[model samples]
Target: MNNHLSKTIKNEMFSHHYQLLYNLNDFKPFGVEILFRSSLFSNPQRAFQKAKELNKLYELETTSISKAITDIHLNSIQGQIPDHLFINVYPSTLIHDDFVKTMKNLIEQTSISASNIVFEINEEELITDHYSLHNAASNLKEEGFHIAVDDFGKGYGSIQTVIEIEPSYIKMDKFFADEIEYSTHKQEMLKSMVTYCEKIKSNIVLEGIETPEQFFKARELGIKLGQGFLLARPCPLEDL
Candidate 1:
């Protein structure tokens, strides 16, 4: 077989897991986050690491995005996919060569508008110059796509990124939700974050809410969006 066919076969082995993002106010569905999974490897990060070793990280990322568009279409699931699809991607993928052209090509083949696709950036990297993170975000924005910064308070992502990128959503890491009910400190920080997010026109997604106490605390802190075991668990889009 040709190299293209080999690569196609490799990417086709990858599939995606979906989780819902919800409206805290009305308890209605707001959107869904697409998490990439691979049958070949039990861990998703290991798949990406293997791709990196093979110099195929871009292909891996691209394939996942394409699969998300058709995931429900090809699945037995009867639920309509939510408009906003928050796709988790590496920061490196966002800055890859021809990334915009490639993503536009993938999105053009589908009925979904580019506006409905939000590229959620995770992992950490040193941001340098306007042409780095800023440029990647600007290019996507120009094409009607959106950006989201993942792992807000933990990992390498920081408040500076939120201020600089001004992403449409700020996903707080689950660490804060671990014991949120009893921690006045965590609650206070969340309240401050909610205010800060409002000031910049960004929504805060409080992740890892696994209990009523944690969920209630998140709601009381004025969080607008949330995702965790309490609301729903991650499952294959086919199961939706």
Candidate 2:
């Protein structure tokens, strides 16, 4: 499966984007997010059905997410990027020993530094089994790749996963970023979350900063790391 993803990602059709590091304040921490230009499975219904059938067979295949990450890493290395690159990964891949082994091997073979690579564990698919996640995170952390809990506030309506995993970075949902201007409640909530993040030595990144107002609001609230159309849009590595 890993081999399959590797081959598919090498296809020239796909392009990768690296999340930029914007400082919240000089004292604020910096970080990045990796996003795909398109959905991993373009056809959701078909993909789900195929995934279900694959599950019935209990077979492991390299996920599109993993392939995309690998692609981003290679791009970064070729471009000589120094910032950490975030890559989204599927839960099934996280639980697969073969995938883990392949990832470790790939890291060794690649020019990208393990410490500058981030694996983004999306909450929608991450909550199924507790033990598998724990072991997967532990294994990845031990290998020097940081973990980020993507879209933290919007999914599953709880912070149980965040508390449990204590990932290296937490990405605020677009909702929070949108609401930071009008609601004191939202502002306070973000402040508390940022405070908690500070205690754990993790950085908080405000996503969807598409406007000047959003950028100012995030900075005023101490969110140094940001992403949106205002600062810079995702581009080919060659452009950077």
Which candidate has the top score in TM-score? Answer: 1
Q: Candidate 1, residues 111-180: lDDT per residue as tens digits?
A: 6778889998875544444358778888899999999988888857477777778899999999988899
TM-score, predicted candidate 1 vs. hidden true structure: 0.90
Tens digit per residue, CA lDDT, model 2, 6-46: 34345523345655667756623244455554345564333
User: In model 1, where do residues sit more than 4 Å from their true spots?
Assistant: 1-11, 73-79, 124-130
Cα deviation at 140, candidate 1, in Å, is 0.5
Instruction: Write down the TM-score of every candidate.
Output: 0.90, 0.79
Point out the worst 10-residue segment of candidate 2 by lDDT. 56-65
Off by over 4 Å in 2: 1-13, 26-32, 38-79
Model 2, position 134, has a per-residue lDDT of: 75
